[model samples]
Target: MKSSIVAITLMALFTKSFDPQPELINKGNSWNKNPVIAHRGAWKKNNLPENSIASLKEAIRLGCYGSEFDVHMTLDSVLVINHDADFYGLHIAQVTYKELLTKKHPNGENIPTLEEYLKEGIKQKKMKLILEIKPSKNDPERDQKLTDRAVAMVKKLKAKEWVDYISFSYDVLKRILVLDPKANVAYLNGDASLEKLKADGFYGADYHYSVYQKGEWFAKAKELNLTINAWTVNSAEDMKWLLKNKVEFITTNEPELAFETIRAVQSGN
Candidate 1:
């Protein structure tokens, strides 16, 4: 009886579950501010596939602080998560949302609608979204439309509290600001001067670690009180560097690895 009670306690402790949501911590928004964000939703091993509901749910189960995914509008103007353009050379914008739902990836994940993703994310409240607006080369007007639609959906779901917008294009970022001035916008390619970006009105920026350049820009970003979240950070040394330098966030393929590494290093320091 004693052994059985111990086993039950261990199982209960390890199997702690929460609502499957986005699991991302917004900048200075959460108490802990866990930096590691699963890319394309913690994808499966051995090339299973990415940006699918299964992968996202798995990410939440793994206890990642957050996850990043792309959103685009279908021909029928429905929002769905997909990383790339289809064979037709356009992204979700070219296909009907119904077609996307009816189709399956090689790994057999049903393409999920943005609403489905948001619903799951909102349930947990800890899961935050780094929504990438993927505009196709074929569609010139698609960026604006995607931004408008995304902003609308976010507002409709009343999920602005848990979401952040990221993009490489300055124009798209501006559009998001116009659509909802309160929305947090992350500049994906932050190679320019902080003053230049700030003058243009940006909330924060994420850059490749290599582009950091260790120059006046880093100091400038810090001075402006801007939030910086770097990307694809996988190395312990890099996480130590980011934490030491006080970068606000990081999105990594290996969230568990990064989280463990950061906590250990911080504890030691």
Candidate 2:
């Protein structure tokens, strides 16, 4: 657990003391600032189709505090969740939402748009967002446009208090800042230092566990005011240790297991 003072100070930085909305303190009710964000919208083990609404709902049912998903724009301008630039075989960016809707999962479920998922999931609010803005090295401009549209929609929906935007591409994150200065931005793929992050104006840092090798960086993130969230953690031992340190978020493929573990610990059972 984070020291009370540290938690208070960190919360104050991201969320003002007078904001009136409750802090998303992950004591037991909500997710930690560094939460367990389900990868690919919490797909069922059987379906294995990432970014499906079915998986998202199943994650919720399992009491996952938050979920993360990819958001790409359709040619006609809809924010849908899919990892690949193309859906199955077709390039999703070139297709309209209606066109993408025509495609079906192996289980016959429909592909979900970001907006649809957000609206559907907002009622729960337990699952905060870690919206990753995917930019291709080959087509950076396309990434920017997709990011801009997603940022605009998020702002229009007034979900600032609920979502954090992250990306490996620095430009994509910068674009989000331009769209919403207060939008929480975390630099994915931890390679830079706190000094470097502050210089770059990044609010947080997220790196893979293999790369998250520095115990010192955790405190460094706290001191530098860069919120820390690690990714794709699935081990019980690692999860326990990180929780002990109060690492803000734990992105994972096994959200159901994570939540169950969190519940077990919280309930003192």
lDDT values, one for every candidate = 0.71, 0.71
Write the residue-wise lDDT of candidate 2 on 1-269 in tens digits. 56987765664553232111233232333543335778877775556678777777776766555677888788887788888888877698778888887788887877777777777766676666668877776787788788888887777776666677888888898888888876777788676776887777777777886665655777776676666677878887677666655667777887767766665544444
Per-residue CA lDDT of candidate 1, range 21-91, in tens?
12223444452245667888887443546877777777777667678888877898788887776613444
* Alpha carbon deviation, residue 212, candidate 2 (Å): 1.7
**Least accurate stretch of 10 residues (summed lDDT) in model 1?**
15-24
Alpha-carbon TM-score of each model against the true structure: 0.80, 0.79
The TM-score obtained by model 2 is: 0.79
* Model 2 stretches with alpha carbons more than 4 Å out: 1-34, 45-48, 260-269
